[model samples]
Target: MELITSNTHQNQIIEEDHVIKKANGNFIEANTLKVTLEHLKNECIIPVFSKDNESTISHYEFVLKTKEIVQDLFPEFSVSEPDIRTSHIIKGRIPSAIGKPAKELKEHEKTLYYERCAFVMEIPEVVENVNGNKLALTIGGVRAYNQENLFSKKSPEKFKVFIGFKNMVCTNLCISTDGLADQIRVNSLNQLSEAVEKLLGQYDRNKHLGMMEKMSRHEFTQSQFAHFIGKLRMYQFMDKTEQKQCFPISINDSQINTVVKNYYHDPNFSCSGDGSINMWRLYNLFTEANKSSYIDNNFERNVNAYDLTNNLVYSLQNQSSNWFLHN
Candidate 1:
């Protein structure tokens, strides 16, 4: 972990010339819609705190503050519009009448507010080329209903923030534990900003890039690939004790199934004509499947994908017994 100091601000900025440009593509994670910051500020209704409850930062405010901090920190980078996912729609009458049943209210009488929300932001200029694919720097946050107790007095509200790389070829975010602050408890925007900055400052971009670049050099033969897929499926049914003996896999069986399908069909990451696939391509197959994950689980699974793939690389380099790779 890198120690953050007063010079952190100056140390964080890349010394390259500023080349402002939008990210080449959009990031539409599962169940999320692309929305502008202005739309979030103007159209969404902020949740009201109960009489005994202290105030907490709103989703719009959180996104805005985080964006401002990133802009200030990386003046040369261009941020994309936020991709937001919302749920548990709260409805009320436009005129604010009391004790009206749901059936009594017409469509026009209904006002709306989302009970939970999550969003992601991409910075295009702070990017690197791994092999031939462009991986851009990305940051995001999750504000979910389960993270807070709405009826309680002033307490720290929990939020999740991550800073990582987004594969521009497929827009699949590559994250690791170092890049994620899974539980940032804060009562105010200033605290949240500090937490975000801390996570960004601690992230090791060169190390991450080196890991991905190394994956490009290792390959899995046709038979090894088949055995790997079969083992993953079988691992899903193994008893908890049995699972503990093997490396942990963060993606579910559904995602493993997707990986199997993509192994043969995915245009960019599929196996070559001789039925051999490099570890980097295999890693991406997992991330492509991860796109189906819900917003809350998305970042976790992405981090896991990197971990699992990196472990596979370790197993290959050391000739260790890896259940997924060995029979």
Candidate 2:
């Protein structure tokens, strides 16, 4: 199916003052405006997924509110892309052979075949042929794993995400945006619970899948932050050093430490300064570990320190994947 996507933004808030103004006349603040948008947009997508596709594993729809990460992934959606590209949905696949989406893979069944059930993204050259909104992903082969669906839309929810106030006005009615959004603060309570639920369900169906592996803060850093895994011994996996030959290169740990320590003192070291690798991925791991960055520079330095490790880590990750799935 060819899915057409478009975006729109304009000023329609001249009357919003009276409707959304505070007692002081400043306007309702950013969060309030954002909450309104979230409710409207979510209403559109969730319904579509629920009604349209019966087997949808998960779904999320929202305006690409953040330019920081969106622009990096898709240059076309650069400032304009992430800034304007609104609404998104992600549905898991139903377990099936290469050509269909019928058999749903249960999570427990997946764990039965592979050494480990890991998530890997695929950098596909052509996207339309792929499922859902995932850029792409690699299912570490285990029969049920490959046969299991990671991205699929079983219901009509596929379009629910696109049915928002902005979408209705901008895309459908061809109207403009209002100034309200600027003042309204929103949150990224970006919920993927449905998706996670499917993953958990899959684990349950397949007895071998077991529960999702709960890595310690250290194990998390090792897995998500590639560069860190090969060098940093966050925690001793399996009593011995988790020495896996997946990563082929060795980095200068002293250099890495210097880079991070030096970045800490630099004023300009925001997360954006990490020089592109897996900054957000690293951030997630640390967040999993319960770390936060109050200062912009520290954020970038730490993220870069974590991202720079992907090259080394993914190698091992892939190698382990090979062991999990037969070539």
TM-score of each candidate?
A: 0.85, 0.17
- Report the poorest 10 consecutive residues by lDDT, candidate 1: 1-10
Best by TM-score: 1
Candidate 2 ranges with C-alpha deviation above 4 Å: 1-37, 40-43, 47-52, 55-267, 270-327
> lDDT tens digits, residues 182-241, model 2?
111111223332322223233221221111011001122212323443335332233343
Q: What C-alpha lDDT, on a 0 to 100 scale, does residue 104 get in candidate 1?
A: 85
Q: List per-prediction Cα lDDT, in the order shown.
A: 0.76, 0.23
| Model 1, global lDDT | 0.76
Badly placed stretches (over 4 Å) of model 1 are 1-28, 48-51, 94-108
* lDDT for each residue of candidate 1 in 1-327, tens digit (9 for 90 to 100): 111112122221212332122354434346655556676677666664565655567778988888888888888768877767665566667666557788888766667666667777888778798756778888888887555677667678888899888877777778877999987998788898999999989999899899987777666777888888888888888999999998887789888889989889876777777777778888988988987787667778888889988888887777777788765
lDDT, candidate 1, at 131: 57
